[model samples]
Target: MSVQHPKESWLIGDQGYPLESWLLTPVGAPNTSKEQKYNRLHGSARNCIERAFGVLKSRFRCLLKHRVLHYSHETSALVVSTCVILHNIMTKAGIMLNEVEDEVAEDFDSPNNAVDSSQYIREGERTRSRYISTL
Candidate 1:
C-alpha cells in the first residue's frame, strides 16, 4: 500500500497475495483512482526494498549483536548508528563480507510456482513500452 505524504509516496509493504489477483483499476471512479494506482505501484516497489533489507539482515551478522559504548545510553546509540552507517557503506562498496547474491532468492514470489499468466500480457506490454522508451 502507498501512503500519501507531503513530498513522497511511501510503500508500506506487500501481502503474500499475487498481483494477478489485484484489480487493475480502482472500484470507484476518479475519487479512488489515484489511490488504487498508488497501491499497485507501491506494492510492487516495496517488494524490492523488502528483498534488500532481507539481504542486509541475513548477511550482516554484526547487525544482530549489541555493543557497550562508554557505558552510556546516548553513546551506545551513537555507536550503533555509526556501525549501521559503516555497514551500509561497506556493503555498497562491495567490501563487507557476506553471502553471495547468487545463493539468495531475490524474487519476492514463491519459487516453485511458475509465473501466473493472467496479468502477463498487460504487464509485458507495459514493460515493453517502458523498455522501448528508455532506448
Candidate 2:
C-alpha cells in the first residue's frame, strides 16, 4: 500500500484520528508548479475547516460537556441535529456565539464565511470532540 501511494503523496484526512497527519513527501519536492499550487490551495482550504472546528468546539460548551437526557436515541439525534443547524444559522447571522475567549477567536480564520467538515461527517462523531460531554 505504501509503495502504491508512494511517500510523495500527501495523506488527506479521513474521519478518524484528527491529530494524525501524513505528508507523502518531505515538505518540499520537485512537482509541477500547477500541482504545487493546487496542493497549497487545498492546504489553505483544509486549514479554514480546522479553524471553523476550533471555533465551534470552543463556543458550543454543551457539545464539549456531554449531557444525555433520557430521550430515545432517534429523538436525541434530531435534537442534536437541530442544535447544529441553529448554531450554523446563528453564526451566519453574525449573532454572538457565546464568546469563548479571544484566543479561540484568534484561532479562527478570517470569516471567509466558510463552513467546517464536522458538519458533513457522520452525525455521531460530529457530536464528539476533544472535550468530554459533561452531561
Candidate 3:
C-alpha cells in the first residue's frame, strides 16, 4: 500500500536512491551557485530520515543490539513494522523515550552504495535540472 502524493509533491532521497518525478536527489557535482544551494537544501532535508532511524534504534534497544536480524526476511519486516506502529502509538499517548545518562556515541555515517540508475538516468537528470533552475 503506497501513500498517495499530489503531482507536484516529491519524496526526498539521498545519493543511494534513483531519482524520479516523485523523488528528488541532490546533484553529485553541482556547478552553478543555484545548483550548489539546491544541493545544500536537499541534503539538510534528507537528514531527517537519518535522524528518524537513529531515534527508532535508540528507542528499540533490541534492534540496536542485534546487528543482523536473526529472523527470516519476512519476519524481520513485520517486526520492524510493528515496532514503528508501537513507537507512533506511544508517542501519541505522550510517553517519553527513556533517557540514557551515559550516552553512547553512534556512527551514523551513510554507506557509499552504488545504486543502479540506468533506467531513470535521463528522467532523473531532467527533474534535477528543472528543480535546480527554480532555486
Q: What TM-score do all the candidates reach, one by one? A: 0.34, 0.37, 0.64
User: Which residue ranges in model 3 land beyond 4 Å of their true spot?
Assistant: 1-6, 62-78, 98-119
lDDT of 3 at 36: 77
Q: Where is model 3 poorest over a 10-residue stretch in terms of lDDT? A: 103-112
Task: Arrange candidates by TM-score, descending.
Answer: 3, 2, 1
Q: Residue pairs in steric clash, candidate 3?
A: none
Which scores greater on lDDT, model 1 or model 2?
1
Instruction: Report the lDDT tens digits of candidate 1 across residue range 69-132.
Output: 3447667567656666877888799885654332322233332233455664355335433332
lDDT of 2 at 134: 21
Model 1 TM-score (2 dp): 0.34
**Leading candidate by lDDT:** 3
Question: Residue 125 in model 3: shift from native, Å?
Answer: 0.9
Worst 10 residues of 1 by lDDT: 21-30
Model 1 clash pairs? none
Identify the runs in model 2 with alpha carbons over 4 angstroms from their true place: 1-30, 62-83, 92-94, 98-135
Per-candidate Cα lDDT values, in order, are 0.43, 0.43, 0.70
